[model samples]
Target chain A: MSYFSLEYIAMITGFLLIVLGIWAILTYKNLLKIVIGFSLFDTGINIIIVSIAYVKNSTAPIIDSAVSLKDAVNKIADPVPQALVLTSIVIGLGVTALMLAYVLKLYQDKKTLDIESFTDLKW
Target chain B: MLYTISTLILSLIVLVLAVIAIIHKNITVAIIAMGTVGLFTSVIFLLLAAPDVAMTEAAIGSGLTTVIFFYVLNKIKNHDA
Candidate 1:
C-alpha cells in the first residue's frame, strides 16, 4: 500500500481505536474506564465517517471566484462529513459533561468510585 | 508508509497504556493513563482527517473526563487500595 494513501491510513487508525476501546472495556474494573472506552469507540466511528468522505487530490470545500464554480465543485472535499463531525463533537461534549455529573453524584452518595464497591445496584 | 507506521506506533502505545492502567494499583495513576489513551486517540482522529472530532476528544476525553475522575478520587477514600 502507498504510504500516503488516505484510505489505508484511516482504516488502520480506526481499527486500532476500536480494538483499544474494547480492550479498555474488558480489562478495566473502573466505571470511568468504561466511559473512556465508549469515548474511544465514538472517536473511531467519527474517524471512519470522515475517512469515508476523503477523495484523492481534493481541495477544501471553499468557493473561489478565480475558479469556475463547476471546476471547484469537482475538486472540493465532501461537506457532509464536516457537518457531521461538528454535530458529533457537540453531542460528545454534552454526553461527557453529563457523565461527569453523574459520576460526581455517584461518589457523593456511595463514597466510592470503585466499580466493585458499588454492588448495591447489581442484580 | 509514514502514516501507517505512525498509526501503528500510536496504537501500540495506547494498548500498552491501557494495560498499565488496568494493572496499576494506584487509582490516580490508572486515571492518568486513561487520559493518555484519550490523547493518543485524538491524534489518531486527526490522522483520520476529523479535526472536529480530534478537538472534542482532546477536550472532553482528556480534559473533562480526567477532572471528573480526579474529583471522584478525592471524594472517595481508600481508592488506591
Candidate 2:
C-alpha cells in the first residue's frame, strides 16, 4: 500500500496519539493532565475506527445524488464503523465528564491536584 | 493526489498538537491544545469520507469537551480564592 494512503495516514496518527496519551497518563502527576491523556486516548481510538472503515476511491456512505442505489455497494465507504464511532464519541464524552467531576471532588477534598498527594487508598 | 497530501499534512498537525497538549504545564493551554487536536481530527474525518463522524467530533470532542474542562477549571479556581 502507498504510504500516503488515507487509511495508513489516519491509522498511524491514531496510534501515535494513543502512545502519547498513554505516556501522559503514566508520567503526569496532575489530575487534570491525566484527564487530558484520557481525552487524547479517546480521540485516537475514534480516529482508528473511522480509518478502518475507509475504502479506497470511494465516497461517504451517504446515499444521495452523488451515489446511486444500484452500484452503491462498491462506491461508498463502510457505514458500520461510522455508526460505531458515533456511539463511541458520545460514550467518551460521558466518561470525560465523569472523570472531571471526580477530579473536582478530589481537588475539593485534598486542596491539591497532585496525584502523588492522594494516598488514602494506597496500600 | 491533493487529497492525499492534505490528509498527510493534517495528520501531522494533529500529532504536533497532541504532543503539545501532553507536555504543556499549564492546565488551560493543555486543554486548548487538546481541543485543537479534536478540531483537526474532525477535519481529518471529513477527508476520510466520514462527514457525520466529523460533525459529531467537532461538536462534542472539540466544543463540548473543552467547555467542560474549562468549567471544571474555573470552579476549582473559585474554590481556591
Candidate 3:
C-alpha cells in the first residue's frame, strides 16, 4: 500500500496525536500540562472526524453558482462532521475554561499544582 | 503525487510540534507549541476540504485557548508573586 494515501496519512496522524496526548496526561505532574494534553487529544479527535468527512479533491460544502445541484453531490465535502466539529470546538473551549478556573481555585486553596498532591480528595 | 507528499510533510510537522508541546520544560513554551499545533491542524482541516471545521478550530483551539491559557498563567504568576 502507498504510504501517503490521504486517508491513511490522516488516520495515522490523528492516532499519533492521541498517543502523544495520552503520554502527556500520564507522565505529567502539572495540572496545566494535563489540560494541554487534553486539548491535544481533543484536537486529534477533531482532525480524525474532519478527515473522515474529506474526499480527496472535493470542494468545500458551500453552494455555488458554478456547480449545479445535480453534479454538486459528488463535488462537495460532508457537512455533518463540520457542523458537529463546530459545536465540539466551542465545547472544548468551554471545558478548558472550566478546568483552568478549577486550577485557579485549587491553587488558591492548596498552594500547589501537582496532581499527586491532590490525592487527599481522590479516595 | 504532490498532494500525497504535502500531506505527509504537514502531518509530520504536526506530530513533531505535538511532541514538543508535551515535552517542553516551560509551560509557556509548551502552550505556544500547542497553539501552533492547532493552527497547523486547521490548515490540515482546510486541505481536507472541511473549511467550517478549519475556521472553528482556528478560532477556538489556536486563538481563544491560547489567550485564555496565558491569561490564567499571568493571573497565577501575579497571585504567587
Candidate 4:
C-alpha cells in the first residue's frame, strides 16, 4: 500500500484508542480498570507519535550501497517515536507495578477489594 | 479508498468494545474488554509504523497488566471475608 494509506489507518486506530481510554476511566468502577484506562490512553498517544513519523516508501535507517548514506538518513523513519516509546514503556511498567502493590495493600487494610466498600476513608 | 474503509471498520469495532467494557456490570468482563482494547491499540500502533510501541503495548499492556489484574481479582475473590 501507499505511505499515506498506512498513516490514515493509524489515525483512525489512534482515535478509537483515545475514545476507549475515556470510556474506561468514566464507567469502570474498579481502580484497576482506571489504571488500565490510563495505559490505553498511553497506547493511543504512542500510535499518534508513530503515525506522525510516517514517510513515503522509505527503508530502515541503515546505511546501504543501494542508496547513498545521505538519502538513507534523509528517508529514514523518525527516531523520536522510538525513543518516546522506550520511555513510555518503562513508565507504564513502573506505574502498573506500583498500582498493583497498592491494590494489595488496600486489600490487606480494608479486607475487601470493592472500591465502594472503602467508604471509611471519606470524611 | 479501500484502506480507509477498512480502517474505519476496525475503529468502529474498537469503539463498540470500549463501550461494552465501560457499561458492563461484571468487573471481570470489563477487565477483559480492557485487554481487548489494548490488543486493538497495539494493532493501531503497528499500523502507525511504530513497531517498538506496538511491541511494548502488546507485551506490557495486554500481557503483564492482564495477569496482574487477574491476580488481584483472585486475591480479592478468595478473601471476601
Question: Best-fitting candidate, measured by TM-score?
Answer: 2
Per DockQ, the best of the predicted structures is 2
* Model 1 pairs whose backbones collide: A3-B1
lDDT of 2 by residue, B1-81 (tens): 888889999999999999999898787999999999999999999999999999999999999999999999999999999
**Model 2 chain B lowest lDDT segment of ten:** B22-31
Worst ten in a row by lDDT for model 3 chain A: A1-10
A12-57: candidate 3 lDDT, tens digit per residue: 8998999899999999999999999999999889888888888767
Better model by lDDT: candidate 1 vs candidate 4: 4
Put down candidate 4 lDDT per residue, A1-123, tens digits, no spaces: 564376766766676677778877777667777766776777677677777776654444445676577677666677676677768767876887788789788888977656788887698
Task: Pick the winner on DockQ between candidates 1 and 4.
Answer: 4
Candidate 3 RMSD to the correct structure: 1.4
Relative to the true structure, candidate 3 reaches a TM of: 0.95
Off by over 4 Å in 2: none
Best lDDT goes to which candidate? Answer: 2
Q: Name every residue pair that clashes in candidate 4.
A: none
Give the TM-score comparing model 2 with the true structure, all chains together.
0.98
**lDDT tens digits, residue span A1-123, model 2:** 668688898999999999999999999999999999999999999999999999998899988899999999989999999999999999999999999999999999999999999999889
lDDT for B46 in candidate 2 is 96
Ranking by lDDT: 2, 3, 4, 1
lDDT for B23 (candidate 1) = 60
